[model samples]
Target: MIMRQAWLSSQVLSRVEPNGQAASVWRFFAGALFPIQLGSRGVRRIKNIAYGPEGRKHLLDIYLPKGPATAPMPVLLHVHGGGWIVGSKHQQAQPLIQYMASQGWLVIDINYRLAPWNRMPVMIQDVIRAVAWTKANITSYNGDPDFVALTGGSAGGHLVALAALASNVDGLRPELGDADCTVDACIPVYGLYDLLDQNQAMEVGVGEIRSFMTRFVMPKSYSEDAALWEKISPINHISPSAPPMLILHGQHDSLADLESAKAFAESLSRISKNKVTFVDLPGQQHAYDCAYSPPAPEHARAVHRFLESVRKDKQR
Candidate 1:
């Protein structure tokens, strides 16, 4: 019962509004258990940087590593998942950004407009714009613009995967008129790849997918926009030029499911010559990395190993 209560409290804490209340909650949580929970070196150089137009869902936070800014570090651009309806980068992705910074990678966690307020292409645009912004200005944060990687979990993972899949799509190209927006690698954790399949699965309470469809795109039911669903689904777009990918899915995640990860890997391997690694995490669920109060040894080791392998491949 205590654990259940704590889980409910965590969800409530996530919904607490106002910047002050949010900060207070962050501080309270950070102080109580986080200090002793993880070994990551917390750096305060993180700051929110807006990339899109004025108003909502136009910002991102860049977490800079505490070290000399002389050499460019590999960049990780993360998107947070709230079923595409509700979420804040400050809450969902801050700790992960901090951890990446501690690992010597500059991290940028993006905030894109959710559904009802915005539509399908708009969120995609927001993500691509964030990529463009990072590619153009991340050097200031000691991040190598040329080596940018995209990552996220659940809905965020879908966006990351979509961004990676759309890297070569002429329509999805950013209007920044700057350097290329291509990412060097991808890490999508428990991301929904097939929107239609996910929507169908969510009918049985697989996740909040039914709501995501309503919030994120025009028309509540995915059936209304069959073509659009196909257009935006990451599983539909795979090519040989697609960036190398590392997909991690928990076996216990009924939300995103392990099949999606396997399907993505199979698609990449069969259709694209790019490297695709699938890590099947045992007995874990979606958003397992969001446990800011405790350490996730399995996730950490898997991610560390994948990053190392990708870095080595980059060196070659």
Candidate 2:
């Protein structure tokens, strides 16, 4: 157990260092250590399946339980978060994905077009495309397409929330086929929900929000058109028909403030007819479950239980 924790720490440090030169070495060691510890957990991984035309950015990785089953397993479509600027389907959510797959679930981690290049709606479109692809083709991999759930942390949490709340919205689907992209349940961990609120809370004359918006989110600044920010925010789109949701946020999160998550949950509970469960991790920071720690496994178990409850409810 001690050795495993050491390797996990090394793995996290390798990927998080600011220095570009040392990153590769840490990544090498992290990569080498992970499989030895996890060993796919009796699951088979299918890599680099294309979901869109964005070349590498549109690709996703799938983890399927080994051997045959009497029935198709529930699917978890995971979106990664990098503040909409940078992030990959790989590396993030390793513990959650592996543990879920080990417990007889089909887990898919996806990548989408980044900002300053892809922009708003495009990132969401890529996610919709990935969902469409999964619904259409996952049966071949022994996954039950109809029982798909969405999960991600940070920016990923935001995207999944938007995808769930705005499911099948014509403006978002656009060129994508007429497939039902609705998920059975959604889990958004430490996600940013209200962009406009975030902008309003920013200190006067601070260009951080403006800089991020201009470069990654949209060409028009939030100040130029504040209403547009609300239009794109997931919190503003919630409805009674939206799927059941599980929100996980750390009390100590620096990014994606906890109060925002609480407010969002309150709104959802008041408005939505479905169940909304919020778990507040004490003393936990952003992306707390990403690393190997006591909290990581405990959160994973919470996720498993939540997913199972949703699945059972759907079965009835």
Candidate 3:
């Protein structure tokens, strides 16, 4: 009996129940049960760090493992997805951030400005700003700034890819010397790649994503600007210098097509001649990894495997 925080309104509940207290029966759960051991460790450092120029206070929740200062640990910056319209770093992301850090990676969960109030490049800029923030301060948290990687799901995934590709974009302005800021790799889960494709996909009832798209760009319509779409879309910006990319998608994903990941991986292969792994988890859907207890949950397991490989590669 969990009411959906996003949609819960006593006014709407009035129709079903004369008494407001009855609304609690329909409570919405963010995901399944989150296992404590696979989640946050009390032994970690929790930092409410800030970054971004103009003294903009973009807060980051950092989880640093208890370890020696002599070593540099890899970092994963996680962006939460609420279709870019609604969500926070504290909720949907806590489970994964906790889990990844428990596996020995320093995890940084960042919050960016949402849509309607902000749009397009701004969202991407926010993520870059967070990465910059991490580069400058992660060492204090026992994290190797040079070994940072990107990971997120859905809109979060889009931002993850965007941050990696836009590293050279003039505006982000990282305080850390540029060397520590570049991403070593990326792991995007069920990401939306093409706006035009997403728009078309929505027409087929998959368009629930329009809420997030419209949120990122508040112009009332995407039809007005063709270049803006191309400028913000991550799929078009692939380069030979791009880092290794591992994209995971559900074969049954209705919101974003698995084909988008395939296309991105193909582009990465053609441009960078680097490793680009695309995994299509059978019988899964978008954000399947978020499940507290997944049926098969291959998506979450795959992420652990990918991170292990990245660690091995780093050691080599």
Best by TM-score: 2
- List the candidates ranked by TM-score, beginning with the highest: 2, 1, 3
Q: Which segments of model 3 are wrong by more than 4 Å?
A: 1-38, 42-47, 53-57, 67-70, 93-95, 170-180, 198-220, 295-298
lDDT of 3 at 171: 43
Ranking by lDDT: 2, 1, 3
* Candidate 2: tens digits of C-alpha lDDT, residues 138-257: 999889998999999988999899999886776666486578788899999998787666424422223565576777687577777666566668887889888899898776677767
Give the local distance difference test score of model 2. Answer: 0.77
Across 49-109, the per-residue lDDT of candidate 3 in tens digits comes to 6665533237778776666545776888888887777777756545556666666778888
Q: Model 3 — TM-score against the truth?
A: 0.76
Give per-residue CA lDDT, model 1, range 178-256, as digits (tens): 5577888888888888766642333344346556575555543566766666777888788888888888776677777
What TM-score, to 2 decimals, does candidate 2 have? 0.84
